[model samples]
Target: MSASELPYQYIVLRCVPRPEREEFVNVGVVLYCQASDFLQAGWRVDVERLHALDPRVSTDQVCAALEFIDAVCAGDPRGGAASEQPRGTRFGFLKAPRSTVLQPGPVHGGVTTDPARQLEHLVSTLVG
Candidate 1:
């Protein structure tokens, strides 16, 4: 990649309504680029996909978790102390070291000239 292109990491946020069965649906994308000091997330609740997995699944916690991710990306104080740290820390904070209703998948990276565009592309590809 060109020098102008910075490397970035991203994780897919998923909703595992049936963790026992290990079933999940991609619900969001979090992208972070320390070189550009950029961090952002994009998400959507695909009701049809969600319902197909578990019609009785409640999304309250999933929605809240997604909102928290967005707040962290926005550098909102409400995201708590982690939001006050550097972008790299914030990115690592969001990565799921443990499984939850709203869990983060594996860490993936790529070089991109524009992090924003890359995030959008990922959201469309993986979260759709």
Candidate 2:
């Protein structure tokens, strides 16, 4: 299906304690999805916000999220080559089969660690 025609979902992950205190504990995942044109863009913005909130968040993890979006836009979940169509016509405002998967870990920690693995698991779960 076309990116615009496909359904999309977003899942946000934040540290526990709604008001977010310095000593807040780890929280589980939070998932939200609605038909909207701004989901993908919001995901990008959230990545920045996530890093700002916790400098520990690694660039690799954030890149993973961005790469996921790029893959979907290009119609390749595996991060393959972009489709033949022109960039403007590719997405066409349709929501893609996109999702944001978040995992908590120490800031600046290696993405090769547990949280990154967890994120990979989430992607695999969604891809299947």
Candidate 3:
């Protein structure tokens, strides 16, 4: 199905560390459905995909990543409130780490870094 026809919204989670060190890597989680419906089918698929890509990552870590994406999308410098709001036409959620410098970095072995880039990769992987 096309992204517009999907049954639920999609979310992009980005993770970053405070103090900005090279060791601080950013990881993204693409959760399906609105934040309230995160336990649904599409969300499960995303969660499974995330685990399949990197089994070492924990659920808490993914949740943290989601929070980060939400902040960035909300345009809140402090990561915004931990509540769901009506996103515009995009029909998706976004969160990111509570950091200032949002830059690209290398992906570690077995980990999928960069939510936006990862989403693009996912689409290409499915289509091609």
Candidate 4:
């Protein structure tokens, strides 16, 4: 049977520069569509708000991490071997939780006909 929609998963990257202080700001988002072999990420950070959250929050560090997410989405060499794998695998790598200034949030799933549009919707609703 043909399918009109497919299930996908996503994670929002959060910056917790001051984890001890229990502060975090959403920095980016990662989305994966296994059926379509598509993986993409989008990010937007409010520097002033980030600084207000933690004066020590480093924009350079967060930007680099966000860029890394984009590179993984593009399968760029900068993303290393993980990005060279299939899109689903790349998504897995990106979605893995990490203890750092920037890290992926819990994985959320939904159905979508267009992964790109879903990505935009996720960014706007969850992180925008």
> Residues 1-128, candidate 4, lDDT per residue (tens digit)?
23879888999989998878768988788998888888899889989879999887789989998888898899999988887988888888887878788888899998999899999988888777
lDDT of 4 at 16: 91
- Candidate 1 collision pairs: none
Clashing pairs in 2: 4-94, 56-107, 56-108
lDDT of each: 0.90, 0.36, 0.37, 0.87
Per-residue CA lDDT of model 1 for 5-33, tens digit only, reads: 99999999989988998999999999999
Candidate 1 RMSD computed on C-alpha atoms after optimal superposition onto the true structure: 1.1
Candidate 3 worst ten-residue window by lDDT: 36-45
Tens digits of lDDT, candidate 2, 1-128: 44444233334333322233443222222121233322222222333444556657555765564555455444563644433334433433222322333333322211222333344454444322
- The regions of model 1 sitting more than 4 angstroms off are none
| Highest lDDT model number | 1
Highest TM-score against the true fold, candidate: 1
The better candidate by TM-score, 1 or 3, is: 1
lDDT of 3: 0.37
Candidate 4, residue 68: how far the Cα is off, in Å? 0.8
- For model 2, the superposed segments whose C-alpha errors exceed 4 Å read 1-50, 77-128
